[model samples]
Target chain A: MLALGVAFSYTAGWLAPSRLSAQRIVDALQQNAGWHPGYRRNHAKGVCVSGYFESNGAAAAYSVARVFAQGRTPVIGRLAIPGGNPAAPDDSSPVRSLALRFDLPGGEQWRTGMNNMPVFVVATPQAFYEQLLAARPDPATHKPDPARLAAFFAAHPETGPFLAWAKTTRPSASFATQSYYGLDAFYFIDAAGRKHPVRWRVAPETADHTDAPAGPPSKDDLTDDLDRRLAQGPLRWHLLVTLGAPEDPTNDATRVWPAERPTIDAGTLVIEHAQDQASGPCRDVNYDPTVLPHGIAISDDPLLAARASAYADSYRRRTGEEAHVPGSAPAADATKASQP
Target chain B: MNTHPAFHPLARVLHWTMAVLILAMLFIGVGMVSTVSSKHTWLLAIHKPLGIAILVLAIIRLGVRLRFRAPPLPADMPASMQWVAHASHWVLYALMFAMPLIGWAMLSAGGYPVTILHGWPLPPLVPAHGALFGWLRLAHGVLAYVFFLAILGHMGAALYHGLIRRDDVLPSMSFPRREPSPPQMSDAPATTQASAVGTALPEQPPEAQPAGDPASPGQGDAG
Candidate 1:
């Protein structure tokens, strides 16, 4: 038995730990985007904010979740750029992420990580892993191998729509001016036990109306823009829940429901303050997409489980490192004053 | 003078070393699953190799245990308490071996490379399959809780013997402490032959000889 144990310990690499495992995916991510210790494996650059979602009770028609019960639900959130590099230039990545955790009454919580894009790039975790590999830069050339990307694009035709969307859309001027979409579909359970498939987005009240002062883009442009805007006053976004038809694809995040789907203006999300993530209340939050409240249930989207796993892995890695936020002391007093 | 027989020196060394390693492994495992920060990588980096180390050490410890007899329980201790002690020790040995083996197999089933020291990736113990990975992961988690509870029980029992009972059970595994000699026996051997012989012969009654026996003081201090 001891010999068998020793033999098992010495043997190396009969099969690759599959790319599908969360660890493998995270490993690939760290490799593709040079590792940044003490930061998120993805969406490394972020600013924390505290706010509240003032529900108008309109969403109670679709689901029985307490957040829609005509009252204020406290929220802590992070605004981030999608990449592993914490100091990546603001304009380098087109995607922006909004991760929020709603602290409801009775100690229940709803956490979500949303993107500014209307649809996600891939339908399944496997494709996302392959995409990461294809996007990995060659050590010699310092660029993604064009042949590998071409082959990936050829094999995964579902990526075409996302690519087209990315090509047509420009990065928003400020984090506050973008509409964040919960790309994955979820089932809203009503009091009667009926499940309604729905997709949600928080549309900024000031989108398209605010003009960014034209200037050369700095590395911290987006973060600076947010700070300048928040200093003046609070910013608000309208929570819109789009009800899905029976034919809508709940499992695939890459597919979009028709624009004409009946939408409900559930609430207004008011961001009262912004703080540095290093010492912000949102620093330790995972923002796992599957962390739902009593009324919300995860759909069959494979990406949801994969995301929860990956986020968990990323959280574990960063928390183990020293709490080193690149640039400034935590504004503890300012953040404390903002709490309700 | 102390008259109780003590464990072999190597057995005591293995016990303390494993005690520290197992405690660290439990904390690392808990931290690894609960967070998504960059530290997750660092914790996992430590957790994988630490597990394998424990496995190797456990095997060696088992070998030592089989080669040498442990100090018998105090003669006055109840039969039920002795049975519990023996059963718990076996359970701990089983967990020490099972935890790492299951962790390795789980990683293998998940298709994750069981890399140690950030390099040397161990071969998969099983082929990659999602369902199997899921089950193995569940088992690893559940067993970890059981392992933790068992450890708490073991520590509690050790402390009970040391503090409340004030018996030789705890001292048997503890580092040997020096004892003052009795002035009356100027030329006698420092330790009683019966105490020394008791360790080498498992069938002997636990050293319950009267105090001031010439061999007792030396046997108590022998490493």
Candidate 2:
């Protein structure tokens, strides 16, 4: 009875910080770096390595034995403009790209490539590139040419729903309440410890268009909106299962993951507070498929594999940085090892 | 060792190395901000340490400046222009040091971990606090923009000398040359004690300001 009470209190404390003063956090860290409670609740009701990363992390459960167990891991995430295009409109709803890094608690380190999009657009590498190119500029206009849509449709016929969502004017029109879909299908493990392919989506309650995408709002409206939403309350996601129902395993990304329903409620995705994702801290982050914990993986989604390859290439080319990190990486030369 | 008692070897070397480093840092900083990939993190890893190292070098450079006097300007150069150059150089030095120091301070204040390449973590030099960090961050950002502009002017002057005027001033300061000094026609050294400092032509030089001098009037600092 006493043990149950202690566990319940610890879990409650984990869910909500009764008090958040320097006094509370410092006291918590000193007591045990908050690990005593943090670890005990590592698999907290709805948490699955997502909390470690500000956004999402590699579900390293499949290959690496390093991050096999639970522990407080070092990680990072970035909020950025998506589509790899520098000129993309800033006001496109779902303000910034959140790339989460999870330094696994016990051993392995993984980084999950996540977005608000549950189902990704394409499955194969070739299709992925085709879609990406199609989404880019028109030679004459030198802007995101609308005619490229036909090329995308011709090459990757399965991007129906994705194109539908991407083409929706509301997302572009409404600046405040924007939803960013990872668009790429990834896998996840259910609370029952069963493997189920899933798509992670960041559904910002306040992210639709408070104003037009071209409104007089600052270019940082997306960031400001995200910050506001996070401050208001924990940002949440509706986990929709993409596998185990009618979705076939091993088929390329060209086909769809037949929807699974009743979509088992796996867990909630939440961002705690106003984490300043800036250039100094966020620039070196990666999104890899091999960074999962114990019960999730790439789901044979060619899109996941292709994304990993695309990200790795772009990551290496742009910054000369490696993407596949093994484990905990605290910045070097700091006298303060842990933040505590 | 040239026409004028130019910048010493150490000062010259530090100036050029910092220039290269700062240019690289700014380009990388700008590139890092626009992308969405692991590269962003990679660039930051470089930016943070390079920034810290620049701060250290700036400190050393400051001590050197305070301890030693820079060589006198060319006697033929205008006194007002020389004073402006001197003042601007000092401001540049101050900016060089302050930008990095403020960056580190901002990181410390914002609760972001500050690290050097040393195997150990950097000590939190400032007390960890949120609001303080925000102010420091704002200061660092504003100063970075200011520094960028200063660098632009500094480089513009250099390019003007190197490209347009075809003068040796830019090369002398930017790159090393150990040739013998031009023989002094006058008994006294230029820009010192009794020698005249202003151009022989008076305030508005009928010919022009020196090749390496700031072309604009307002840009001349109040020495």
Candidate 3:
């Protein structure tokens, strides 16, 4: 019976603390990181861009989603540094993120938020909450104590793999050269009535540029590099869909599937231009992964649903702040309304 | 039904094959729900393919059983015992069929594909829906408990017949009884070997008394 209780404590999401909701988790994260007013919630420092996704028609064989029908669809994307600080230096952060929205016909949109890291740190939302609490800064020092962090690792040994991954993964030179992974699995139903669980990753067409920087890195290093690259020509990435094997852990994003699994090169994503986040298409949009197209569905991974709720909470908090930030939200809306 | 001394060879083979498979499946099922270990990923891999195999084999067993007539119960046995023997066999068969289908449907409703190989896809048997998945999962879990209890009862009854009653019922489905010639002569005298062979082939036209009598000379061969 004690063993069963421990099993439920680690695996079952429903048995988590009743007071802990998506809003509460996000609020706790923001508080621990020291909240920055008038900034987007998690990935606060970001650049938005407009692009086109050209499907190779191969994705249609796996999913009947209209967006994968071998044509170019307008896409709004955002590149960001992970954390809640809007003014965090780009060179200081190792993990970067990209949120994409593929706007199909009939207002049907497929939105996904991905990070450069291959997997998430924790398997369950409750554990993630505990992680936030562990890393919370001391009231006097205003920084997390090393002792608290050590105790956290001791209690939750499952987090060791993610920490090792974070330590080993090198920072990318530019967002265009980084491969962003969708950490959760999604179900893709083909026309033949077969549903397969799949996870997606945007693999940069350009070779990795992980060599040491030529000069001292600045606060806007990534953004400057992205601008320089887009001026020369359109930047491209291949959206690869990997089929999950039965042995692959579908419910846990903290664990990754083996690299030997087969992957389909679904399509090419072409970035046309990069713009400031406050006045770009990605500002008003919330990249909720659960808002999928007809043929694509969310897998039973608990983290997927938790992520959707967290994104919703983040979206609500940011939008509610629009009244105070006159230059941020309304300006983007005005510019969009004036465009074709 | 009274003529055949033991079960058909095909029936016996299916019974033992299913026994091992079902026992393995039960352990895998218990292991899956008991913990949140990384090994569960591999356990799930073994479970889906094994369940499908059991489903396919159970259908064949049902067909083989329907085609062949089962041997009669001991003539001296009570009617209630006979009724229980008949009813429990049907229930066991029903559970063997129902368990796999429920598992398949639960996975389908949850929008998870039941694939064996990396590229080989087992098509969804039901549409993806959250509420249906919840209900199907609950039904699958409840049936698992019922199936476990039924297996215990089945094993208990088999032991009662084999050890306490010293009857042919247990051996009928076992390996030693299905051979063409009786091996009872190893222990019994050569003259009684003919009687042992006769008891083994009670399939003589409707003379149920001589063949199924538990107290006959062949009873010595049972031990």
Candidate 4:
């Protein structure tokens, strides 16, 4: 019985009392990948794009970051599907993601990775690791154990809202119509050194196009649709920031701030052109959200630092694979490169 | 057998106010669970404060009931129907008070603070507990359905009295008009209707009962 307990813990990735390392978490994510080697641990398949972000100067009230200055800043963005397999079909994934790097004046940069999901599934980094473990496929069945998943869910009641949301939220017909939300909170420091916690999301100007095709969606449906739409006009998303109220739970990404809290329209992110990652300017970029300009700093949210560490680990691993096999699968992999 | 003895002006006012608020609350409650859009946030803003309003008014309405006699049920009404009327009114009172409290406790157990008027926060009514939160949420939802059914039943009965029966039952708890009662009023009925109207009028002082004035609108009705 004691040995059985040890085996269960080992398989579940709860390596005793020590806090989970970034590598351990990333490895668990990779284990979820099906038939994909050296792919991004998460959101591997995506289309890179060129864009510019115009700040409305409203965000300046919360943060003294120069990135929020009222000007057009060059941007490299990637729209992605939520999965670890680079070759997975677009519609196979339920959540769509947006990762961006904004070039600022004075050689600084601001980076962010967002998802169409309003809230993340787990609250803490440990809980997230456990979730990955619970989702891992059984070696024999090649599917996650239903009993394990149920046990994990029962333990994490905080996941209730997110699970409820996933069932009801409609899949977007086009990337242009999907609103991308940053699942973690960050602290913005004003000139007075006062800090305010904020979470932000990009709301598309176009209404939600939730009418998914009745049948199997084409493999490149999102990318193809976005490219064709860009030919008509530039797609725009508004940067809306909700300031946290006093009782707002900043540490938990699963809980949403009360809607009545004041929101500031930070500006607009305009996607001008869609490009494949192969030769796109954003090809070599890593949108680690912790890479912030002045006046923006990490909050006490444990998930933020965990994400930063995991992103660093992912970037190094992917780049190492590239170095090992230069130009080997460039054409096939570039269109579905590790993006978010 | 069909007579109109107006409800106390306070009861009428409370009924109408609560009616609009409860309907709005039900829709907002439904909307809160159905979407994660910005509109959902607006619904919550209206939902929390509005629930508190209903809870507060239900208490005040119950307290005011002590000062006056409720109008009698129709002489020809079935005994079972009369019993349902009394039972449903108490159920409405209980549910109106309980829904907000349950919602408050549910949010509290879920570790969410209820916000009012901008950002004014209400203290949690219960400790944060997942199982308790789930149970309270389920209870709140179930009771809402019961509350809705009771409201429908109440409204149907009112319509039957007003439109089909042409009785004064509907007017008893609604805005009183100057029209003479369709059925001849007895002494007790006349004074009760007069007092109900007096309470309904915003300009009339509720405390202005004249000594030795049995017909004064300020005089409390005898059951």
lDDT, residue A181, candidate 3:
94
lDDT ranking, high to low: 1, 3, 4, 2
- The TM-score of candidate 2 is 0.42
Residue-by-residue lDDT tens digits, candidate 2, A1-340: 2343344334223334542222232222222211211111101111111233222223333223233233334545445554432333455443334455554433334455554444456655455444544544433454445666676686666777556655664433322244544555455554455565555444554544345545565655555665665556655543233344544544444444555434333233444544443223433343555335545555555455334433433332222112222211223421121222
Window of ten residues with lowest summed lDDT in model 1 chain A: A331-340
lDDT of candidate 3 at residue A33, scale 0 to 100: 58
Cα lDDT of all candidates, in order? 0.72, 0.45, 0.69, 0.68
Model 2 stretches astray by more than 4 angstroms: A1-118, A122-340, B1-4, B35-41, B105-142, B156-223
* DockQ of each candidate, alpha-carbon based: 0.04, 0.01, 0.01, 0.00
lDDT at A97, model 3: 93
What does candidate 1's lDDT look like per residue over B1-223, in tens digits? 4434566788778778887888778767765564333344556668889999999998887776666656555544564765566566766777889999999987776444566632246777997544465456666777887877776777677777666765555666785434423531321231343234445445423321211111212212111
- Looking at model 4 chain A, report the run of 10 residues with the lowest lDDT sum: A331-340
| lDDT at residue B92 of model 3 (Cα atoms) | 71
**lDDT, candidate 4, B8-58, per-residue tens:** 787767767788788668766654443322343456567888898888987
- Output the number of the TM-score-best candidate: 1
TM-score-wise, the better of 2 and 3 is 3
Model 3 whole-model lDDT (C-alpha atoms)? 0.69
What is the Å distance of residue B126 in model 4 from its true position?
59
Which candidate wins on DockQ?
A: 1
